[model samples]
Target: MNQTHLATLLAVLEEGSFDAAADVLGISPSAVSQRIKALESDIGRVLVRRSSPVVATESGEVLAQAARRMALLQAETDVALRRTIARVPLSIAINADSLATWFQPVFSEVAKWDNATLRLRIEDESRSMMLLRRGDCLGAITTEATAVQGCEVRHLGVLRYRAMASPALRDAYTDRTGTIDWAHMPTLRYGPNDKLQTNDLDGRLEGKPVNRRVSEIPSSEAFLEAARRGLGWALVAELQGRELVESGDLVLLDDIVSDVHLYWQYWRLESTMLHDLTAAVVTAAAEALD
Candidate 1:
């Protein structure tokens, strides 16, 4: 009935769990469950299936779409009345590596805006654009050049990655000639959806399986940490892994590098707040990303 309830429903659908949604909305799981129950009672229809991983019902999908539109419109209205309304928080999506490395400075730079706040959703670069397409975020830092529907794209910069491993791991896998066969080495992956490392290996090794002995660690920091501990070799962003390399925690496996060209994509809506936020992000990216 109210925006709070609608927002709660949207968060549950986006996060796929009551607890996760509650965390995002800064409410307790009980409060989120209560909101869903009340919403169902008012609508006379179950909006979500109560299960291990919550799923939105058909009715819930419709309402979720409505809520997204309403939220966007509300943002627009706030921007139009910027002098009257307090500064608005901008919701954004970005990859974990970028967030860990270059993205935080953008938020610091933008802190100069009297009324702006940033709500960040950290996803993989391959999937971040999907967040923008689904209305979960106003803008995204993504690897894809193609713009999502209703959005425009701007080239932010390229993120370069180097094949890296701990010295011990490298010594175990590499021959005296410094020649290495990737298929023989164990690999550390960012997540199930991550193909950055695999794709890099593909380009270098001609479609060979990347050391089937793979360890899947989902978090950016965790993945690097795993690599540092010699769990497996990993492809790491140059910016993120540089200090480790200098400290001898990681060694470059080969000169082979992967460069992912990143783009900023956002809805083509006419909103001053969105515009200002986009400018700040782009400026920051230019300074941070090579």
Candidate 2:
């Protein structure tokens, strides 16, 4: 209910610490603390989790979103009233594949909004929703069909991932019978957080999952490089590897593939900018995804 204090809380959660929030607000750290304390007293609830990098308690997130939504609405009003609004900063979360493939339209759309400036955070599609839920981002491209509460989810398109390896690896590994021992081979992983290979393996090998965990090369480009150098087979996004596959550099391992259906989730706030940007992003994705 208190807009000023609510904005303070949003800043702390966004900046990830009280001192950082103070730097953004041009206020003393003690002042930031006093505002948060006053806000907690007024709301009768603990708002921030006092960690090295501060985090919002569950109710704190709701208040933070409320403040963000109000800011968006205010910006829209200012524009409509023929008033000058400096850059309106909007943060959105996106996965790597989408960023690499269909993001040109997002740039075009944002550029049309003279006052809207964009900051992008990259996370795995499975995890990007967490950033949106925390108010770190207002929208997300994610692999979730169900919307996070207070956000609207739209099915954009399916991003197809293929199990691939270098031609040399496949030649040495796949026999005349086209059979390969997947369990014993080295595997490439995007990161410890990545489970695409595990998910693919689990789907392929019925009872005995290989329990195969290998490399943790998180860079998408480097993952392809490792695959090219025969480090291991990997599930690469179709967009990222289609050229290599066509050029006979990366061999398509098998018919087995992973098609992750991506969804666009955004705050349900009635902001014209969000609506326009969402439409632009979804339209662009349709051009690339199935």
Candidate 3:
């Protein structure tokens, strides 16, 4: 297969359309279509589904990952030769809580590498690894410690979460016995994908279901703000909501806390760049996480 054709396929997948990819590559849409056709013909398999926004077929994903690895390798070579690389892609997946908290320092570390162009796909820790499986990202911060095939896992650290509520919300849920009513209080979740808040709370409540009204607020900061404003109670990470919990803006519920063990998973590429990034994440985890 031609290297340029492989890149063209990857570009179409990334840019989501042949015309957009053509603009990026400084070629006409016809040229992009021709390259994709040539690549498919050489591979003897259909690679992309010709939708309004093109999507890679399973076979095409393999080529896309190969292209990404090739680009990463070429960037490393350029770095060693003291040559300027236009953009060395560093696509990664991260959890929303981490993005709202310990992940910022990692961003700073990434900027220290001038050759890298960052791409982030945010999701729940439980689902972030899907990006790696799809060849969409080279690495991810995830809750699963089991290594993906052809990948390695590094245990970063546990991120602790405290169940917090506003003063008024807490009083409404507290009963005459000085014990809190767990079932009636309104609960807030980061999104439909997030089960952590409910999962931990259910376990702590002794297999009892938290049969409460749930509001789905997707953004990390906004979710915390909703909890602070007494809209509902939520699991608050220390890095994002510690101040509110400390300043009496948010009340810790039942003195209970949850620890989420985070792991860094990446393709087992023998690249120094991957190793450096892994080290940077581990170091930042030590500084920020429990």
Candidate 4:
């Protein structure tokens, strides 16, 4: 019915539960239930099936699409009425790994532009595209090659990471034949989804015993710091780890390297502010990341 009701229903469907939707919408579960009931009554259909986790019916999908369009239109209308032609906030969703490495330089470059504000949502690279589809963000730094609906993509550059350890640690573990048995050594890992170090180790071990003794360091900077402190070896981004490597704090683990290709994806709307921010990000990425 109203925008608020439509938004509440959409949130409930996306979040898959009334309680989760209420938490996101900053309202009570009872309020969310009432709004959804009102919406279902207005539509004259059971838009959502009530279960352990809510699911949108076919009718709910139609309403959800309409709700998304309405929200986008309202945003454009507000921008037009404010007479702020090129000053709209540029909302971006980016992965944490990039944010921890080269993305901050990109932000620094964009911040120099005075006309627009930057809003960032940090999630995993694999999940950033979902934020774009849900109208949660205007752009995303995604690993995805295929663009989301209503968005365009550009290849920014590749971020290269090197397997690294502390000099003392590397010397202690590596042998004369250059064959380091990781199974006997501790490892510093990013969260469970982090494949940079583990994948390489898996290949090197080749069905042999490899160290699964991992310390879960979620923050990128912390992950590198853990390696530097000789807590364990990790894959550190070239940009973030280069200075430490040069300072003799960290040592690259022989020739093992991982390169992650990154792309910038943004809505294809005709917004000059978004264009400026994109250009700035691309420029910075080119400089900071290969």
The global C-alpha lDDT for each of the candidates, from Candidate 1 onward, is 0.82, 0.84, 0.87, 0.79
Cα RMSD to native, each candidate? Answer: 4.1, 2.1, 2.0, 4.2
Error of 1 at 96 (Å): 1.0
Task: Flag regions of model 2 displaced more than 4 Å.
Answer: 82-84, 209-213
lDDT rank order: 3, 2, 1, 4
Candidate No. with top TM-score: 3
For candidate 4, write residues 1-290 as lDDT tens digits.
Answer: 87899989878876889999999999999999999999888989988888867877778766775675565556556666775554445668886678877777766666675555667777767778877776667789988999988888999899887888998888888889987767767888777776666777787678696448789988877888899999998878888888999999998887866888899988777665567777877887887777
TM-score for each predicted model, relative to the true structure: 0.79, 0.91, 0.93, 0.77
Residue lDDT tens for model 3, 141-161: 999999988899999999988
- Candidate 1's TM-score reads 0.79
Q: Per-residue lDDT of 1-290 in model 2, one digit per residue for the tens?
A: 67788889988988999999999999999999999999999999999999978988998887887788887887778778868665567788987667877666779878878788898997888889888887778899998889998899999988899899898877776668879877666778777667666777666666575667488786777888899888988888888899988988898988867889999999988888888888988899888889
- Candidate 4, pairs of clashing residues: 183-211
Highest lDDT: which candidate? 3
Off by over 4 Å in 1: 1-8, 11-53, 57-66, 72-87, 203-205, 208-211
- Candidate 3 stretches with Cα past 4 Å from truth are 82-84, 201-211
Least lDDT summed over 10 consecutive residues: which range in candidate 1? 80-89
Question: Model 2: clashing residue pairs?
Answer: none
Give per-residue lDDT, candidate 4, residue 111: 65
Model 2 Cα displacement at 245 (Å)? 1.5
Answer with 1 or 3, whichever has the higher lDDT: 3
Pairs of residues clashing in candidate 3 = none
